[model samples]
Target chain A: MKFTKGRLLEKAKEISTPRARRMSMTINKTDFRKSMKKLVDSEGFKHLSTITGIDVGPKIELIYHLTRENLVLSLKVKTSKKNPVLPSIVNLIPGAVLYEREVHDLLGVTFKGNLDLSPLLLPDGWPSDVYPMRKEWAPQDIRKAMEKP
Target chain B: MATRIPFGPQHPALKEPINFMCEVSDEKVLSVRPRLGYIHRGVEKLAENRTYNQNLYLIERICGICAFAHVTCFSQAVEEILNIEIPSRAKYIRTILAEMERIQNHFLWLGDVGHEMGFNTLFMYSWRDRELVLQLIENISGKRVNYAMNTIGGVRRDITSMIMPSLKEGLNHLEERAKYYTEMCTKDPTVLRRTVGVGMLSPSDALELCAVGPTIRASGIPRDVRADDPYAAYEEIPFKVITYDGRDVASRLMVRLDEVLESISIIRYALDNLPNGDVRVRVPRRVPKGEAVSLVEAPRGEDLHYVRADGTEKPVRVKVRAPTLANIPTLCKMLIGENIADIPVVIAGIDPCIACAERLVFVDTATRKRWMWNKQELRKYATKWYRKK
Candidate 1:
C-alpha cells in the first residue's frame, strides 16, 4: 500500500513498513544519492529531518529520514564498519551538511564530496581517528583518550 | 581588507559557550564560519548502554528549558516500540505541560532577545512576568526544570484540583502580558530600530536551510510539529500555526510572543475538556525488537527522537536531533551580508540553546589591524552604533 503511493521512489532494494506514519526502506549505498536527489527534486522531500548513523557490528547503518507533509520516509544504507565511506547529499539537500558531519564525527563515516567533514560534534582538539560512537569504545576509554595530547 | 572576529565560548550576549568566526570589513560582516561542539556530552553513546526506562531521566537533561519536550519525544518513541497507547488523561496532561513549557520558553527567549539588543528593561519585564508559568509548572511537577513528568507508557502525575485553579489564573495573566509585550515590541522605536528589517531570511531560504519553530514561522512557514504530527492531545486542542511574512528579527520576536498567547489557549482548552481516565498504563519490562521515530514540537522547534530496541530492556541505539542544531546552519545563512553591530541580535533571534547545539572559541590572526572584541565590546559597540544614529 505504501509503495503504490511512493512508486516513483521505488527502486527500493527492500521495503519495511513500520506503524503507519513512517516507512523505512533499505537501499544500496550506490543508489542512495540517485534516490535522495529524486526524492528532493520531484517528490517534495526537501526537508531533511535528520540523519542517524548506528554502528551495528561489522557495518554502520546510515538512515537519512526525509519528511514531506505528514509522512516520513527513511532511506537506510549500510557500509562496512572497517572503512565506511558514502557519497555526501549536500548538493541535493543543503540541510544535510551538519547531519553528515555529525555522522562522520561519531560513527567515522567519510562522505566523499562533503566540503568540510572536520569534527562537527567533537571538541576542537579531538584525535583524528577516535570515533566514540562505535560499539567498542567505552565511556571511560573515550574520556581518557579525550584527556590526552 | 577584512579581519576575522571570534564571537564566543564566553558570550557577550547569549552568556553561553559558542563561537562564530566572522570576517568583517569596516562594520560590515563579509562571511560567517561557526565552530560548535564545546559541550558534547556523548548522550547518544551513553544511551546505548542504559536500559529503556533509565534513559528517561538521562534524556530529559538534554535541554533544561525543553526538558519535558525531550522526555516526551523519547518516551513516545520507546512507547511506540512497546506498542501500548497511553491513556487519554495522560495525553491531555502531557499536552498541558508541553504547552506550559512553550509559554515559559518563549518568555525566556524574549528576555534573552531584550538583553542582547541592550534593552535591559525589556529583559527585566519579560523575565519578571515569566515566573507565573514557572510557578504554575512547579506546583504540578514538584520539580520545575526536569519535571520527570513523563514515563514510557504515560505521564507520572495528574493535574489535581489544587493546581488546576492556579493554572487557569496564571494563564489569564500570561495572556494579557503576552498581548502587552506584543504591542510594546511593535510600537517601541528602540525595539523596532534594533530588530526591524535586520537578519532577513526569505521563506525559500528558511525552508531549504531547514530552519524550525519560530525561526521558520517568522519567515512565513507554518510548518509546526504539533499541527502537522499530532502528538499527545495537540490534535484535540484547537490552535493556529502562527506565521509572519516579515522574515526578519522583528518577525521572530512577534512569532514567539504570539506563540505564548497560542500556547496559553491550548493549555486552557486541554484543561477544560480533559478526559477522565488513568494517567499511566503498565507495560512489560522488555520492549519487542522494533524501531520507531517520534517527534515533539519543543519550545524552540521540532524535536526528533529515534529509538531502536533489540527486544531487551536496553536500547540498541537512541538518537536526538535538537532544534538548535537544525537552526545553526540557517543562523549561519542569516548572518552573512550583515553588519558586525547587528550580530548579537541576529544570533539571539534564533533562540539558540548552545549547550545542546554546540560551542568552540578560536581567533585567526594575519597581517591586519585586528579589533579583538568579545561579547561585551561588541554589544556595547552595537548599542553605541544605534545610539549615535
Candidate 2:
C-alpha cells in the first residue's frame, strides 16, 4: 500500500491535525496502541522513527514520530504526570524498546510490558525517584543537590 | 554454560564508551544487552534552560562528527516555529556544509572500520584524505570539528568566489579517492573475507528495527531523508540515493563510500547554481508558542529534532533524536549468532556513536583517585578548558 500522510489521517481523522507535508494529532491515551497498530498494519507508516516525551506541568506528553516516503505523521498521547504509565508499543515495533527506556529514565514515565526498563540513559546510583527531565525540580534545587558534599 | 562477557565502557576496539553484556556459548552469541547513558549530558534538559539561539551551540556538541547536522536540524526547527522563510542562498550554503560534514564523517567511519578489521593501510589512507575535506571546511567556515555555521533563519557563513577554485579542487580530489575506496572495498579479497556476509541484516529486519542512513540503505532500502523529505537545498540539488543489497558489512561500507561521491556532486551543483541574497535574517529572541519537527539526513542516518516553544525566550522542550540511537537495536540484531571475533567489525559496521547515544561519566585515573564526576561538572570543566585554550 502507498503510505501517505493523507491515508494515515483517514484512520485517525478525529485526532489528526493536518500541517504542511505532515500530520500532527492527539489521540486519546487509550487509543494510542490501537491507532498505531492500524497504521503500521496497513503499511501507512513504514517506520517508527523515534518516540519523544516532554513534561508539561501536571501532564507528560508522548509524541510518536512515524515516517513513510516523504510523509511524517506525529501521534501525541498525554498521560497524567502523577501516574505516567502508558502502553508499550514494543510488541508492535520492537525498535521502540530503547526509546521507551529513555523516556522512563528521564521523565518518570512507565511503559507497561517493557520488561527491561532498568535505566537506558541514566547511570547507576542515580537517585531512583528523581526524574531530572521533569520541571518540578528547579535549576537551583538540582544544583544544590548535586553540590552537597 | 552460557558464559557472559562484558564488552566495554572501555575496550580496545571501541572508539567511544559503551558496554554490551554478551551471553556467549563457546564463542557463539546468544543475546547482547547494551548498557547506555555513560555520555548523556541531559542536553534536552539543558535546552529547556537556554534560549533558542544558545541551544544551537549546545546541541551541535552532541556529536562532533555530525556537528553541522545537529545545528542544521535545530536551526530548521526554530525557523519553522518563527514561521520565517530563509533565503535561498542560506539554504544552499547549509546544504554545502551538511554534505561536507558527511564526506568527512564517512571518511572517519571508514578509517575506524579499517582499524577494527586490522587494515591499518585503510585507516591511514582514509584519514589522510579526510584532512582535505576538513581543510575545505576550515576555509569555508573557519573551523574544522564544530562548524557553528547554522543560525536561526539561515546560515552564519557564506561561500565567496575567492574560495570556489580551491574548494572545487579539494572536492575533485575527494571524488577520486572515494571512487578508489569504493573499488577497493568491493574487490579486495581481505576486505571481502571480513565484511562480505558478515553482520547480515535483511531489508525487513532493517525496517522493523528502524535502521537509518546507510545502514538501512545497505539492506536494500532506499529511504534517505534528503531524498524522501528534501530539506535545505536538497529539493533543488540532484543526487542519487545510493543503496546496496549486499546486506552485510561490505554493503554498508560500499553504501557510505558511494555516498561520498554523491555528496561531492551535490556540493558541485549547489556551488554552480549559487543564489545571490542575504545569508541570514535577524530572528526574534523570543519564539512564539508552537512546536516544530526538523529532520535532516546526517552522515550516519536521519537526524531528528523536535522543539516546542511557549512564547518565551527559552524553549519548553527540545528533543534530539540522534541517528546512532536509532541504529542501536539494529546493531543488536546483527550481533547475535555471529562469531565473537567479528564483534569489533560488526559493531563498527553500524558506525555507533556512543557519545550521541548515552549518558557518560568522568574519571581521572592517572592519579589512582577515581571518583565519578557529574554531567554538569564535566560539562563546565570541558567548556571552560576548551574555550580558554
Candidate 3:
C-alpha cells in the first residue's frame, strides 16, 4: 500500500502532536513513544534509518530518522544537558541499539534500557564524562587534555 | 563450554578495523557481538565548526570509496534549505557521477569478497574492470577518488562532448566484463560453496533490524533510496530496483552484479540525452533558517544527511547516517547460529565500510592497555590475568 505524507502524518498525530510540514514532520519529545508506535503500526515507518544527536544549547536533541517506502519521517526528541535520560526504544525498534549507544557515547544521553551504553565511537582513554559532541567541550579543552602528562 | 574467538578489530578476513566476538561450540557460532569505534574522527562534531562550503571537502573524506555519494547527499541537503533549483544539466551530471561511483564500489566489493573467499582470480579480474570505471571518472572530474565535483547549487564541472566518446567506450567494455562476471558468479561451484545458503536472513528479520541497501534487498525486500525516494535525476532517469530471495551471500553478489548492469544503462541514457545548461549556480554563504533531510542511493545502500541552519555561515548541525551503520545490526543478526567459518563471506556480503561507520575505542590510560573485552566482567578478568602474570 502507498501513502502520501499527509495521510502518514494524520496517522502519526493520533499518538502525538505531529505538525506536518512540506516534506517532513516534527514531533514533541513527550509523545515520542506513542507517535513512534503509531507510525510503525499505520504509517509503515518500520525502517530505522539513523539517529542524529545534536547539542542544541541547553538540551541534546536526538532526531530519529524513520522511513517507509518513499516517505521519510524524522521524530525530534530532546533531553536536558544536566540530567540526560530518555526511554530506550530498543524493545520497540531493535535496530536502534547501536545508534542509541553512539548518541550516548558522543552526547552523554542515557537510553535507560539499552544494556550496553559502552562507547560506540569514542577512542579508548578518552576521559570519562567528557562528551566530545557537547558544545561545552571546546577545541582548546580537547587539545589541553590530549597533551597533558 | 562455548569457546570465544575475538575476530579482528584487525584480522586477515576484515579489510578495516571492527571487532566481532563470537562464542562457538563444535565450530558453529552460538552468538556474535560487534564492537565499533576503532577509528572515530568525530566528523559530525567537526562539521559544526566549519562553514558549509569548507565542510564539503571534510564530508567527502567520510568514506574514500563512497566519496561522491557523501558530497551529493550533503549538497542536496544544503540546497534544500536554500530552496534553490539546480539546473537540469547539473542534475544529469550528478546522476552520472553517482552511477559511476556505484559501478566502482560494487566491482570493488565483488573483488573483496573474492579475496576473502580465496578466489584471487575473481578479485584480480573485478578490480581490473574497476580501474576502467575509475579512469573514466578521472577523465570527467580530473580526480579519481575525491571528485569534489558536487557544490551547493549544482556541480563544479560540466560534462562535455569531448569526454562522451571515450566514456561510452569505457561503459561498453565494462558491460562485457559485467556479463562475464555475472555468468561466473552463477556457474562457478567454488563461489557456490562459499555463498549459497550460507548466511540466511528472512525478510521479516531484515525489516525488523532496519537493514538498508542491497543487504535488505537480498532478503526479498525492494527498499532502495533511489527507487523509493527519487533524488537528483532519478525520477527522470529510469532504472529497475534489483532484488533476490536467496537470502544469503550469493543473493547479495547477484543483486550487486545486476545493479552494475542497471547503472550502465542509466549512465548511458543520461549521457546520450544530456541536457545543456550551466553546471553550477552561486549559492550565498548565509543560508536561511530551516532544516532539511537529503537521501541519496549510494552503492552500498542509503546515504542520508540532515542539515539545520540558523541563518548563519556555519550550519547549526549536520547529521550524517552512512548505510553501514544501519546494516551493522543486520550483520549481527546473520552472524548468530551460523558456522564460524562463514564469518568472512557473510560479512563481505554486506560490503561494509567500517571506516565510514566506526569512531572510537575503549582504553585504560592508567595501565596504557586497550579494553579488549566489551563487558566489565571480561575487563576485570583481563586485569586479574595481567596482575597474575
Candidate 4:
C-alpha cells in the first residue's frame, strides 16, 4: 500500500549513471557503501531481498536487490576480477551476512568488514581458493578439486 | 562454564540437514552459529550450463515442497528476458497451480509442526487433509511433488472445465478443514504453551534481517510479493495480505493458517474467472542478451530467481534465493535465550523443509562430557518439561 515517491530514484542519481531505470541503478564500486546507506536510511530501502554475485569476464557484478513495498531497486556494483573486494553491508543491513558469505564462497569476492566469511553452502574441507561459480571452473574442474589429495 | 550443543546437519526436528552449533550454559542458549550447505547441489552453476528450458526443471528441484514456485519464478524471469508476453489464460492457470502448491505446502508444514510439538493427532489429521489437496494438484498436472506444468513461455498444461468439479470439491473440503485447524491452533492450550512467546522476532528485526513470507507477515509486515509486485494473475485476483502482530511461533502458525484460507479463496477466484486462450507460446531457444529478477510469494515466503541471458541457448547466470535460506539468520537469532527442551518447536517454527530435524548432541565444556538425543527423545523431553511447568 505504501509506495515511495521518486526519492530513492533521486538519491540514486547522486552516485549512479544517467541510464538508471525506474527499478535499477548502476553505481560505481567506490560509492557502493554510500549509495546503499543513502537508500536504506533516507529512502526506506531497508529490505534487502537478496544479493546476486555473477562473474562477468573481467569483473564480478554484485546486484543488491532492495525492496520497499512494490518498488524493487536493483543496485548493481562492479568490482574487478583480480581484486574482488567490497565493503560489507552487514553493518548497515545485518541480514546480508549469509548472502555475503555465499558470494564469498562461490565467487571468491571478499566482504572486507564481514568477520564471519565462513563457507555457507560448501563442504567443510573444500579448497579455499576454488570458487566454482567463476567461469573458469568447468563441471570437470569442480569435480577434480573435490577429489581427495 | 559455557557448554556447546551441535544441533544438526541431520536435524531431527525440521527433518533437514543443516548444522547449528549453539553455545549454552546449562539449558540456556547464549549464542548460535549456523553451518549450512549439506544439500548444496550447486544448482546455480548448473543452471548456467543448461538451456533456458532445461534450467526450468533444475531450478524447481531446489525445493521439493515449493517446486512449482521455483519453476514459475525461473520461467517468468526467462520470459522477461525474451520480452514474450504470455496469454491471459496462461497467467490464470499459473495462479491456480501456484495457489494449489501453497495450499499443499502449508498443510505439509502444519503436519510437520504438529509432529514437532509431540501432537500426533494434529499431525495425522493435517497430513490426511494434505493428501486430498495433493490429489487435486496431481489430477491437474499428473504429478504431485515436482509438477512440471510451467515452461519458459508459459504453463505446459491447461486446466479444463472437466477438472473444475473435482478441484472445487477438493478446495471446499480443504476450506472447512483449514478453518477448523485455524480455530484449534489458536485455542489449544498445548499448542499455545509450545508456540506462544517462542521464537520472538520483532517487526524491526524481521525487516532488518530481510525475513520473507509468513515469517515477516506474522511480525505484522503485510509485505506479500503477490500483492506488492503483482506477478502472474495476482494483480487481478483479490486477496488479503495476512498479518499477525504476535511475532512469535504462534503468530507464525496463525499467519500460515489464515493464509491457507486466503490461498483457497484465491484459487476459487482464479478458477471462476479462468479465461479462454492458448496456454503457451513457442519461443526461440536462444534468449536475447538481457537480465531480470523474478520474485514469487511461495508457501514459506518470497522465493527469488534471477536470470541473465547472454544471447545463447544457455544462460550466463542463474541465482536462486530460497525462502528458507533467507530466514536462517532469524532462526539463529531466535534460538538464543530459549530452553534446550524448546529447541525443536523453535526450529520447526520457520517450517524448514529438510531431511531430518531435532537432533542435539550436548558437550560439557569443563568436564568434556558429551551426550546425544534423537528427534523422538527430544520431543518427549519437551512434553515432560512443559508438564512440569
Best-fitting candidate, measured by DockQ?
A: 1
Arrange candidates, best TM-score first. Answer: 1, 4, 2, 3
Q: Which residue ranges in model 2 land beyond 4 Å of their true spot? A: A1-18, A143-149, B11-14, B354-389
DockQ of 4: 0.64
Residue-wise lDDT of candidate 4 within B232-288, one digit each (tens)?
999899999999999999998999999899999999999999989899999999999
DockQ of each: 0.78, 0.71, 0.60, 0.64
Candidate 2 structure quality by residue, lDDT tens digits, B1-389: 56565556753334568777777676577888998877777888888989887898998898889989989999999898898999999999999999999999999999888866767799999999999999999999999989889889888888999999999999999999999998898788768877889898989999888899999999999989998888999998989999999999999999999999999999999999999999999999999988888899999999999989999999998999999889989998998998766667788898985321122332223443334433234334433443453
List candidate 3 segments past 4 Å from native: A1-23, A146-149, B11-15, B354-389
Preferred candidate (TM-score higher): 3 or 4: 4
TM-score of 4: 0.96
| Model 3 C-alpha lDDT versus the unseen true structure | 0.82
Clashing pairs in 3: A121-B359, A121-B360, A122-B360, A123-B361, A124-B361, A124-B362, A124-B363, B37-B360, B40-B359
- Using DockQ as the measure, what is the rank order of every candidate, best first? 1, 2, 4, 3
lDDT of 3 by residue, A1-149 (tens): 35554665443332332222224556666777777788788767787888888898998888888877655777777788899998888887899999999888888999888998877777777787788888888766876876675
Task: Put down candidate 2 lDDT per residue, A81-105, tens digits, no spaces.
Answer: 9999999988888889999999998
TM-scores of chain A in all candidate models: 0.91, 0.84, 0.80, 0.86
> What TM-score fits each model?
0.96, 0.91, 0.90, 0.96
Which residue window of length 10 is worst by lDDT in model 3 chain B? B354-363
Candidate 4 segments whose C-alpha is farther than 4 A from its true place: A1-22, B11-14, B355-358
Residues A1-119 of candidate 4 have per-residue lDDT tens digits of 23344544444442332121227677887778887888888778888888999888999999998887666778888999999999999999999999999999999999999999988
Per-residue lDDT for B268-294 in model 3, tens only?
999998888899899999989988888
lDDT of candidate 1 vs native?
0.86
